[model samples]
Target: MSTPVLVINSGSSSLKYQVVDADDGGALAVGLVERIGGSGHGRLTHTVDGEKHRSDVAVPDHAAAMAAMADAFEQHGPDLAAAGLVAVGHRVVQGGARFGHSVRVDEAALEIIEELSALAPLHNPANAAGIRVAMDTFPDLPHVAVFDTAFHLTMPEVAHTYAIDRQVAADHRIRRYGFHGTSHAYVSRQAAELLGKPLEETNVIVLHLGNGASACAVRAGVSVDTSMGLTPLEGLVMGTRSGDIDPAVVFHLARTAGMDIDAIDDLLNKRSGVLGLSGSQDMRDLVDAVEAGDADAQLALEVYCYRVRKYVGSYLAVLGRVDAIVFTAGIGENADEVRELSLRGLESLGIEVDGEANRARSKEPRDIATAASRVRVLVIPTNEELEIARDAVRVTGS
Candidate 1:
């Protein structure tokens, strides 16, 4: 039996979607709509079985983007009406404390999602808009919201709470709400399966190292701790984000550098990290520069890896015993030098990477740990679309 679900990830001006099978976790078709409501015509690229169909047309809003997507499906292959799609899964970035799991989209749920926009000024509004437009487009299919923070909602209070003013924190809903939950959930389960162990019996540390990165400690299939907090900006050093910075730096910059809050926010979130440090954001380019003896690039790589090492060590202590340390996302899966550099001196922690295995490249899930290492080190590609699809199927009974 095949269970097809349409997974939608809506950004402020872009909508990326995929029709994935919940049974096998394979994408049937994938498409992306960009530049919605922009001055120029929006562009759409739809792929079916390795064949790509592209078009540039006007998409004035989320509604127009949805219409464009429908047109692409009609013109290309695997027509949505005949594709037997059971439900629509929306990837919501911030669910706050209200949504701890996937939920069927309804009036109340949509309202809550809209209200939470204050916490995620850039994401929730767009997600809610897309949900509204998608509901109107596919009125017959169930729409499920699979939040990125849902998986981390299982973290204990000790792991999630911050040492802040109790009244202020309560009033503002300030606490650790980790992002990249879908990737962490998918990678941890895949790691458990790769280790030939039951998920409930496994303790794994997942490093989702992409442009936006985070580390998660999953104990017995539940998230115990994670690196990211209140926003995606609090975790490991990323392509553009300055992670784990002292809060007083903001005040210092305000006083000394004459910078405002928004300026500091833009600096840390957009102009910092490896890009700010090395003058480049791409790891491939940065790695080449490091090889060519660029001092800035070398420092960037060291800083990035050092942050990762810190998280790994902390998670090891948090979990007490780890069965596998899994790496996923773009940089984690493809950058061998990063994998080696991050765990450079963790041999005593039973997390040693096999040189040959780590260097070897493949798309399939693999273990790169040495035989003598106590913990299995793995590289597993994240399938967030599939995870969202599965959650949608379960929530909607579709």
Candidate 2:
């Protein structure tokens, strides 16, 4: 068996992990610990070799969660010790401009990651917490950090810079640092492979449409432009995020409604998007509601898909000529109606989706565009964990 890498993706209240084989990109085990620090019982579910194991443990914090995860591995088969783990990979969301590639986690690296937490308040702290705990638990193993913003660092200034004063922006480190870099990089490369083209020669657009959505214009396997700006809240309409709203909206709310910055921030980041447009934020629920003739849901669907189409059009113009438009992540890969609606009326742009092909339900990557269509529309499921593991192996030279 090949040396496995333990990939950890720690969120605000959850920890997800996978043990992946470095040699062949196979998942040896996968698990999650949810509801951490919550009053109610936290849940730990682990799977090894397709056999599932679950526990309702009180995981009061990241440390406790890590211990429980170790317990799960011991109770389940394929223990970490037996797996011959080479390294532990942590998925850090915002690496900023400093980290353009994955690196071995050292004291200086950890300090930098903590310092950059200002750019990702919701993500970085949690990621750091996981890192600390993982380091303590697996003291002998090498730890690597694979950043989500690393791949997008290749974006040019025109695409990543804002229209604000250069001095002020530079002083504050305020520039577009697109999220989902790992997913974009993996999906775009997979799209090139699916098209039977070399990655360096491929020009593709990757639409990662989960609850948190973003579009990337990847030309010749590099991100020339992407939809997300300084934060994830600046991108496409997400489940709860109000993407691409006028900056004045916050000021308007503050002036007229006497809303504070924190309240306004919460409104835009936690209470907007499809959730604001319609009653529900879940795409599946919205689709069902649309079929049931819910006007609000229909409008929400229209607005969401329209935003996607606009980004696709913008990216098409950016790339000039596109090889494929790849759809990955939750809603992008599974929601057929969303894909169809997003790509509709783009035939003139050489983007056409075959109804039959688009409707096909499969996990494998496949083209959804008509043979006559100039640009291919494809659905490639994302594997961020695998990508993190691969990066970890590469950085550790394992």
Candidate 3:
């Protein structure tokens, strides 16, 4: 693993990237090109070091975004050539049951990932396209796919299996394939380290709250249970995705609302959650409205935090001996109000967040638990790209 690796987290319309030193696993540079297909006015902003380098790139697709990201690297801080990015690692959304671990991308795997688009219509195809573009852009480099669901492959049949017909489940591969595995896996280890115990002996819950959110219960480092089921939309409320809707709602919408399958799909994936509950997708606006006495915004925040709290309490019971509760991802790491509200009134379960410490914004992982609390509430920033790079190195022996 002496050669550096470039890790790409490709979304439907954006590509987030980081270059890591293969030998030491240190991130040399990281940036993201967001808002790809927003409107006639589109922008790609790459922030490296302390400066931001932006462009008005006509990114009609992810391929264009990837090229713009490359241009950003050339113009910004670290030079890729000097960075020695010998290999590339991709964060694939749904690798399906076919891949349980990171593997070198082959023609067969690419086809399988494409086949999985039905499962993750909003994600898999875009991810496959990004992989294809990466293969084209860096033909000589070894490309690896670190799956989002691979870490949760450890879930027992009872945890992953649904209460449906066995034949239907088998036909559709309809089982829990949790997302944010890299974040959950990374945070679990960090929580164990912070507790100074062997991961196998430690029990922790990880809550990943970003544009998308999910909760996981990690026992002995393996994901024994997680909130995300089959897809990212099954867990906690998110920016634009509904979580844990009634099974009847799908059928009801199709029947009464005259909505087709794709229409319903788009509604759940793109127009629901906090955005639908409140009026804005951004939590900042929601929070602002809540402070200004907006009932709907307040309700959205309450619902969001309550769902997280429910999972935390449930996971504590599942683990039987809770070591820590980890808060990570964008909202989990930065939103003080979300953290404070989510862990409130959990002292009986040995989980407590220090009011003063929770408000302190630190870049490094910091425990925000009150000294008296038995279970520590930690704010551990997730580094999924770095984790992908480490795995890529391990799998490839780069």
Query: Highest lDDT among the candidates is held by which one?
Result: 1
Q: Which residue segments of model 2 deviate by more than 4 Å?
A: none
In angstroms, the error of model 3 at 338 is 1.5
Task: Please provide, for model 2 over 1-398, each residue's C-alpha lDDT reduced to its tens digit, 9 standing for 90 to 100.
Answer: 58689999988899999998877889988999999999999999999989999999999999999998999999996767777888999999999999999999998999899999999998999999899999999999999999999999999988888899999999999999999999999899899989999998999999999999999999988999988888899879999999998999988999999999999999999999999999899999999999999999999999999999999998889999999999999999999999999999999988899999999899999999999999999999999988899999889998
At residue 190, what lDDT does model 3 achieve?
A: 87
| Best-matching candidate per TM-score | 1
State the local distance difference test value for candidate 2: 0.93
Give the root-mean-square deviation of each candidate in angstroms.
0.7, 1.0, 2.3
Expressed as tens digits, the lDDT of each residue in 1-398 for candidate 3 is 45678999888878888887756757677777777766764577666666777777877777778888888887886877776666799998897888888999989999999999998988898889989998988888888999999999998888999999999999999999999998899889988998899988988899999989999999899998899888888978999998988989999998999999999989998999999999788888899999999999999999999989988888888889888889999899999999999988988877778899999979889989999999988889888877888888888776
- Relative to the true structure, candidate 3 has a C-alpha RMSD (angstroms) of 2.3
Arranged by lDDT with the best first, the candidates are 1, 2, 3
Choose 2 or 3, whichever is better by TM-score. 2
Backbone atom clashes (below 3 Å) for every candidate = 0, 0, 2
**TM-score of candidate 2 against the unseen true structure:** 0.98
The residue pairs in collision within model 3 are 1-398, 200-220
Q: For residue 383, what is the lDDT in candidate 1?
A: 93
Q: Tell me each candidate's TM-score.
A: 0.99, 0.98, 0.93
Higher-scoring candidate on TM-score, 1 or 3: 1
